[model samples]
Target: MSLNRRCSRTACGRPAVSTLTYVYADQTAVLGPLATFAEPHAYDLCEVHSERLSAPRGWDVLRLAPDPNAIGPTTDDLLALADAVREAARPVPVTVSAPSAETGREVARKGHLRMLTSE
Candidate 1:
């Protein structure tokens, strides 16, 4: 089910960005972005995956556990998960102007991708 508060992980103060829903007796745990705008579906995430959900890298850690006993959203309970997801996924509209030609050209000159080395 969707949690109202942030992740229980103390070091990760980031909000609970996903759900770890396990269906009763099921061997899978459904993991979904807490920000999904649609109805929550059955998508299981393993222990490692759930931990990464709120990670700072903006990476989705949703994954299926290898063993069925791990955790999985049961077909029995239908929590008010969609509502929470919609709330988290609410989009904030913003506008950005096109980059100037100079900026684009400079980036091209530096190559498509650049890696910074410590000074």
Candidate 2:
């Protein structure tokens, strides 16, 4: 349940405080607050790494101010989470129709499991 992500730097076990992403085409590096999710191309950096980060010789670095209030979830975040929980808890209507032989594949799914029909 831990939401914190570890820094991408080797030997640095600190929690990530910022995210680093490079724009190859523009030869620019962007450093900002930790992302809500781990992006495949972005690097998660600790406070120290983020502060000490330097771009390549020809690259420019863009550092964004990390919002102090973003360290924790806000009221809107809590309310959104509550709304999502309520939505998930509500019963969903599932209309099962006889599968046509021509289209035997599963048409839809919900959550993690699949509803398979025997052909």
Candidate 3:
């Protein structure tokens, strides 16, 4: 039993390696890497199906391939993720600064909001 997501084509149960989406306004069919999540309008395709993909008359098919030598999820990516998590988890210090004359004073405090007096 394979855990891979299957191709969207009917009767083709092969694992999907790419994703296909149509740009109706541009008359273009884009084939790129497998999406992080399945979209309602996008179609997941296997290698064979992706290679055999075609567009209708006056439509262009754009195949976006990954860089051959580029390897992702490196140490920098992990470090950046960790840094972002730490920044998000860190407590935000609250400060009440004196309002300038032009800005006016805060009149009412509401849920995640504050009403200010007009000048």
lDDT of 3 by residue, 1-119 (tens): 12378999999989998999999999999998887678999999999999999999999999999556645556897999999999999875544445545577766554466566777
User: Which ranges in model 3 have alpha carbons more than 4 Å from their true place?
Assistant: 1-3, 91-111, 114-119
Could you tell which candidate, 1 or 3, scores higher by lDDT?
A: 3
TM-score for model 2? Answer: 0.58
What TM-score fits each model?
Answer: 0.26, 0.58, 0.61
Cα RMSD, model 3: 4.7
lDDT of 1 by residue, 23-95 (tens): 4444444565543332344333333447655432433333443443524454442355666778889875443
- lDDT agreement of model 3 with the native: 0.83
Question: How many pairs of residues collide in each model?
Answer: 13, 0, 0
Error of 2 at 93 (Å): 16
Find the candidate with the highest TM-score and give its number. Answer: 3
Report the Cα RMSD per candidate. Answer: 18.7, 5.6, 4.7
Tell me the tens digit of each residue's lDDT in model 2 across 6-117. Answer: 9999999998988999999999999988888999999999989998999999999999996766667889999999999999999866545445455354554565544666
Question: What order do you get sorting by TM-score, best first?
Answer: 3, 2, 1
Consecutive 10-residue window with the lowest summed lDDT within model 2: 94-103
Off by over 4 Å in 2: 71-119
